[model samples]
Target: MTPIERKLRIFVVEDEALVAMLMEDILLDLGHEVSAIASRLHQACEIAQAGAFDLAILDVNLDGKPSYPIAKTLRERGIPFAFATGYGGMGLEQPFTDVPTLAKPYVSEDVQRLIMGLMPSIP
Candidate 1:
């Protein structure tokens, strides 16, 4: 018998509205629900502080602002997250270098693979 996959509640922080929408669609297709989406650093930080999520996909840069604050909040909350950046992992600072990252223009499989690595039971 096939094991039932867990449906994770995910938080997404992307400054680009279209990118966020695409990610939402992709997450839904992957059988996960997007608990919340924030496009600004302050708003994302607020959501990170107040919301509960299994995981988060954070854009390293939100407009002209950095997403490190939100990442910090998630870290304190014990939530796992991966960075999504157009500039690749090189864009991240030393402190965040060890975190997983997804390069921009990622496909559904890319996201699935990353999340599966983070949560083995996801697939």
Candidate 2:
């Protein structure tokens, strides 16, 4: 299957309820499954540790705290992920500066691009 045709299990970490729902909706509309949603740093970290999904989109700030720890966990587990932020990838620190990013207020096309970025060989 091609990247557009593959169904990914996506984990979403966003503090804002509406944004989380939006991400989930976009993922669903793209024919992917939302494996889980985390709205806080601690919860998101736990989910990242479990690493249950094929890919993830992480909000940069969760309840005023950075989601870097969750990003670290995802990296350690080797699960592909992208940062979702209004500020874009400039907020990222060392070792994660180059990870894919999905800007805020996303639509289906942005989500599709994110999917392709994370899994270029998704077949």
Candidate 3:
């Protein structure tokens, strides 16, 4: 069966509204339910804690604030996630060194593949 058929739930945290919309569209098209999308680190953390998402797509920087706190919370909850950034490998902080990342301007298929590979049955 296609990965989407499993119906994973994902949360998106991106500072750019347009990018968030595009990511949302891609996730929706993949047949997964988007639990929430937020632009600020505060809002993102709130949603991430409140929502029962299986995974998350985190933007390393939200405005000038780093998303490490949110990423830490996800890690504590045992939720799988990947960084999606425009900064390439230079964007990651030491804490996120081992997590998967996808550079921006990426193909939608990459998002789908990463999600499917990391969280086949939802976390």
Error of 2 at 91 (Å): 2.1
| Clash pairs detected, candidate 2 | none
Question: Any runs in candidate 1 off by more than 4 Å, and if so which?
Answer: 1-4, 120-123
Model 1 lDDT tens row, 57-81: 9999999888999988888887889
Residues 1-123, candidate 2, lDDT per residue (tens digit)? 234657889999999999998888888878899999999998888888876689888999898998889989988888888999999788788888998888877788888877977886332
Query: Residue-wise lDDT of candidate 3 within 1-123, one digit each (tens)?
Result: 355647878899999999989999988888888888989988899987777888999998899998999999998888888899888866588878888887898777888778877875353
lDDT of each: 0.87, 0.85, 0.85
What 10-residue stretch in candidate 1 is worst by lDDT?
A: 114-123
- How far does residue 107 in candidate 1 sit from its true spot (Å)? 0.7
In candidate 1, the residue pairs with backbone N, CA or C atoms under 3 Å apart (3 or more residues apart, or in different chains) clash, namely none
Model 3 misplaced stretches (Cα beyond 4 Å): 1-5
> Order the candidates by lDDT, highest first — what do you get?
1, 2, 3
